[model samples]
Target: MSELINNRQERIEVMKNLIRQLHEGRDEEKVRRQLESVLQEADYSDVFLMEIQLMEEGISRESITKLCDVHTKVLKKHLDLTETPDAVPGHPLHTFLQENQALLQRTAHIRKKIAELEKVSEEESADVLMKIRFLLNELMDVDKHYRRKENLLFPFFEKNNLHGPSTVMWTKHDETRSYLKSVIQALNEAENISQKEMIAFARLAIEPAIESVEEMIYKEEKILFPTAMDLLTEQDWYDIYLQSPEIGFCLYYPEFEWVPEGGLVENVEKIKASDDKIHLPTGSFTLEQLINIFKTLPVDLTFVDAEDTVRYFSPGKDRIFDRSRTILGRKVQYCHPPKSVNIVNQIIKDFKEGKQDVARFWINFGGRFIYISYYAIRNDQGTYLGTLEVTQDLTDLRALEGERRLLQYDEE
Candidate 1:
């Protein structure tokens, strides 16, 4: 092989061949050495192109995902030499790196605790186990981190027809999530197990979970971030930055506000179109009138699209819960706390599957009895369109003693 491998197509083929060798169980170190000259000069885009081309050639995404770690192992040296894209404070990439730093610190702490478990006596093992559970609980926050990537960042890749790698990365995210869940469950059920058994479980379940997270950080900084920086426009990043708050941050949050040199722009055409009347089968209303009608309704209303993105929320004067514009493009799962996300997912799942159409619940919050109902929005042809959430403060309604036939106005 020549020392100077300059042709773009040749570089791609060499990279692809190396990855194929990895898939075929070639010795990683040997293959790496063979590809050293080519990889030494390969940048992040070249690596991305290699994966995309492999996918185009009918390589299964599952196969690529399975080989992803092996690919990383072979490419780690050159990837380390690859320059990371610089991002200012509050930029999405900067925030992701910061979260990775926090996650690394947490994983280090967990490893130290695991080591301490070995040293501590049986009398002290309980305390060590407790600390590990607490850390694992915090580690679960990584779901928000991954959700931000899948929901906020990956869409831009899809728009660019660069969907394969994102799918592969998402598969890895699910794998990490499974490991975290299994470890957490094993820890939760460790009460009756022997100390030796507990230690074995820790080794079996915990270590892999932490390593999955760390490996993802490596992939992001080395390949994904740099390639995305090369491919995505400034506007794409700006949109991601704005919508990130809906999902929130992981262990870290950005304190510094990042404003791009180019300011945020509103869609002027949309604003102009708002003045025109919207025609419906039965009636017509200007956008202003439509908005006012929603605001005047007694219940707070939010509409999430079929894809689970929050698309609209009514600005009622007395909403049972707060609503913000930041949530407009956010995923519905992130709108709820971690504990309730499972229920939210279940509701959407049932709605989409047509197992159910409406879910209702009532809770006493802040001394107010609030009634919440979720209706699956569907089209005339019975196709699921999205979900409509209607929330009302039912404290006064629950106290009603009698009803009057005639309408009566309450005191001002």
Candidate 2:
């Protein structure tokens, strides 16, 4: 036992030293090799937490991040014993990687354009600058990638008491966000920036943001993810895997197969069976009956669970907003596209913390105006139960002149 503990400690020390060396500008390949050897021999999940700490200490090594991905591939292969096949093309990880591939290709094209701009005469750089800004706007997808992690992945980690890596990664994510904003602001404010100024801005803003992302990959693979794998049961991972498609991935695709635990599968089957009928406080109704009732009603409805998972969405045939069953059980953050995730998250947080009760929005759609409102649902003790989202097509409602004394029937 003593010898085993000593070996673990020695491996941890070596990992820390490699990170320190990388941070100090030592040969990256050499440090990476040393770290790789330690990782191969170590119980990866156990030591990954320590590695995350090293990354948090300012070691932004590209080689280390690359190796970390390699490590994940290896560990996943070793631990994956199920008969299920790998995720298909449209799987969350696959979709995420596909999106990332496009983003990376775009970034590369932008970099080349920026380089070409430097070569051109100062009198003709405006076009290139405009293209650069457009590229930056496209690059805003990184914010979406980060949101998937923060809202979906981080909550799982928090449930497991592994807050260290998630917190550090969130801080780094915010730094990247701020850097992107600063670069965009600088570009917008410059009426005529010299080549030297442009280069400086690229180095100061873009390079560091990219480096931070690389380092985040390191921390996730070496620490955050491994710890999650250790602490989370197979069912827990399966739940994440099932819901991941809605939010998407950051850069790389995880090509592993995930099979839910037998117990989880059984439980889910039970839920599905029971879903045929709903027992309310006053009465019971078949699922189909409930659906018909909600669709015929004047208002649309959506239900988010106490855990903030989007559990139910009433599909009114003429829904004021679009929704899909795919988004059911998804974190509310993932349901919205990247640009709106922050606002969604803020609303959810406020709702959960009991700081706010109602949020409303109005919009015009297809010549008809609509109103949407989210209400925090609570129990008798004021304990939050979930949220009720109501949306109504208000075009007719807004035009109402007076209360109708007699009912009129329209052809069905």
Candidate 3:
């Protein structure tokens, strides 16, 4: 009732007491009443602050993890603000909301296919497996969504002193990730998958994962987005948008661009003033010159170090595979799918053993001739360094039967 209780420290203490009481068999209604007295009619990030404080006071993280969703349920009905955030098309929040909607649709399709299999004969179920597999594959693409939240958005929450929510949610992310993996594995292992097998996998693996994902989306839209909207400034959002491309987009890409009012549209200027020239054995190249050289290359190149870490990927005119800053420190094995990981490993093994200098894959993809190669990098002394992945589209080159001796301008 007093302003003194409104102090965040005091509120956190009250929160701790309330949580303890609730765990000690106090009446749920009374606890809800206590929350009602403290919360104003708005987004409640104080809940985040309270949990962060409790964890800082030596409470185990696992303890808070278990109570996160439970306490959110308790606080849900007591809060006045239950409206979904109003994010414009170009806004980052809108993109996330769109992705969640897409994920829900994919899950619904998965469930529907599984339901159809329940009543169908084994032959009929056979027809459903391909559809189920496709949907499940799309669902695994939720990784991009989760990675963006964990790497990009969560850091902002931590910066704004809302540490506990991010930590707890990250734990839940892992749980959902495990569930997703199980579902994928189930589909992968299915041999003659009967109608019964389809039903069983859906119930045991797919259903639980889908439920967890949907629940997380609910919590995020209800609590996380609102709290972020209340806390982050325009510049904070601009920084997030600029960095988002590094994590890649989820199911939905923004339909419009959001420009911060009176703000510069680029990253804080990073002039190459500190080191203008890069010296090499051949000669020296200016920073600008070296950058242009990489851009001028006809193929896309990604360099992986001896540590199996992605160091750099050239930004060419066109790229065949996506690379993000998040991939910088990630193991090369994880960059591929769960199945192709073995082939990748084998290639690396062959290279490391000096048995092979190159591995290549060429295919006709989407009516284009695509060539992919991995070359083992080594020093003049033949010491193993790393590997370089080079990809090129040779569609035009393959089609060229005649050569142009001179450059000539033709009338348009």
Strongest candidate by TM-score: 3
TM-score for candidate 3, please give it.
0.69
Angstrom error at residue 408, model 1: 38
Q: Write model 3 residue lDDT over 1-412, tens digit each, in one string.
A: 5665467667667778887676667888888788767664323666777778778877778888877766777787754366778887777888899889988998899888878887787787877877777676667666778888898888888887778889998998888888887777666666776677678877887888898888888888888888888888888787777677666665666658776766455434342354687999889999889998998898999988787766788977667767654455445765675557679889888888899999999998888899999999999988879999999999988887877899989574
The lDDT, on a scale of 0 to 1, for candidate 2 is 0.65
Report the lDDT tens digits of candidate 2 across residue range 123-242.
Answer: 667667667776665565566577777876678777765655566567667877787667765676676677677767776676665555544554454455555555766665566666
Q: By TM-score, rank the candidates, best first.
A: 3, 1, 2
Off by over 4 Å in 2: 1-6, 14-47, 51-96, 121-124, 158-161, 194-196, 218-231, 241-412
lDDT of 3 at 155: 87
Q: Sort by lDDT, best first: what order? A: 1, 3, 2
Where in model 1 is the C-alpha error above 4 Å? 1-6, 265-412
Measured with C-alpha atoms, the lDDT of residue 54 in candidate 2 is 58
The model with the greatest lDDT is 1
Residue pairs with backbone overlap in model 2: none
lDDT per residue (tens digit) for residues 248-273 in model 1:
77778688766666654454345457
Where is model 3 poorest over a 10-residue stretch in terms of lDDT? Answer: 265-274
Candidate 1 TM-score, true structure as reference: 0.66
